[model samples]
Target: MSLADLEPNSLHVVLHVRSHPPKANDFHWGLYLHRDFEAGGTKYHLKGADKRWLADHGTTRGVFKSFLLIGLCQVARIPSGLMKDVDAMFRTYDHQLNEMPGLTCRTWVFRVLELLQKPHSGQVLLECNDLTSLEYELLSWGNANALAAADCQQPRPTHRSDLCGL
Candidate 1:
């Protein structure tokens, strides 16, 4: 499925967790294309050791960190169709950030969404194979955002802090 199919200018936010011997063990998160497609940008595409990731970027290592997608949510589906190329846009966005090593995936999600134009539904939902910790931050992000939108006085708790133990 191509990201275009889900609807252009939309983001599919996913939460992942893997406590195995493959590599690092921790809760992870990433973004994915809504539709199965021929091609999309590096960030929008799910790049990793998988064949799907290799076919596109020619590297087993991809921009996305979360592998074993445990949960997902259409964080915001902008009705405004994206123009130019989604990948190209992401390149510009990433370059602007001057991404450094150890860049948090949550930060990536927060930043990429900034490029999209306004006027979108704030509602979000997550579906995971198992019921787990991903739900906590999912609600945390949503709750913190709602508080900010309303200009709440209390400082929201740092997300990554007790959530991931990172």
Candidate 2:
């Protein structure tokens, strides 16, 4: 859907997952924030090849194309007013690869989720409560989809629903 379709003063937080490599169950994570029509949103994701996170202020379609998205772990509705705050939080969200344990796209996505789940001005940003459950859900989906595709020698999932069972 186009940005115009979203409700005023709100945006969508989509947690995306894709196969990492070498192993089917190994997965990477990313986020897509779709804001209202006026303030175009951005994508915060890690490029496995570069081993660093990249934020792209490009068209939603273009970002999705580059993501090679496999599944959506979760979709949340957040107030559009929090856009700048969230972006700033992302920019300053301490991500020291050397100090981190097994740093990957998943770690970055998890940190983002932790930030979003915090109460902002007494208002919770994301609808989710438990981050562990969210991770488990995504892991389950990845194991099923990734392993199936690898074993069956099937093409990558072509539809959004195919990946997440949404």
Highest-scoring model, lDDT: 2
Model 2 weakest 10-residue run by lDDT:
157-166
User: lDDT of each prediction vs. the true structure?
Assistant: 0.38, 0.53
> Candidate 1 on 1-166: residue-level lDDT in tens?
2233344343455554443321323434555543223343233422333221211212122223233443335544333343234334445444433334434555455445454333223422222222235445575554334433233223222222232212
Cα lDDT tens digits, model 2, 1-166, are: 3444444433332433344442544665666666656754566665544445444333354432343344333345555577778767665544554355566667777777777778887776766677677677666666666654434342333222222222
After superposition, which runs of candidate 1 have C-alpha atoms over 4 Å from their true positions? 1-10, 20-26, 36-67, 78-80, 83-86, 96-102, 117-166
What's the TM-score of every candidate structure?
A: 0.41, 0.64
What is the number of backbone collisions in each predicted candidate, taken in the order shown? 6, 0
- Quick one: how many clashes does candidate 2 have? 0
Clashing pairs in 2: none
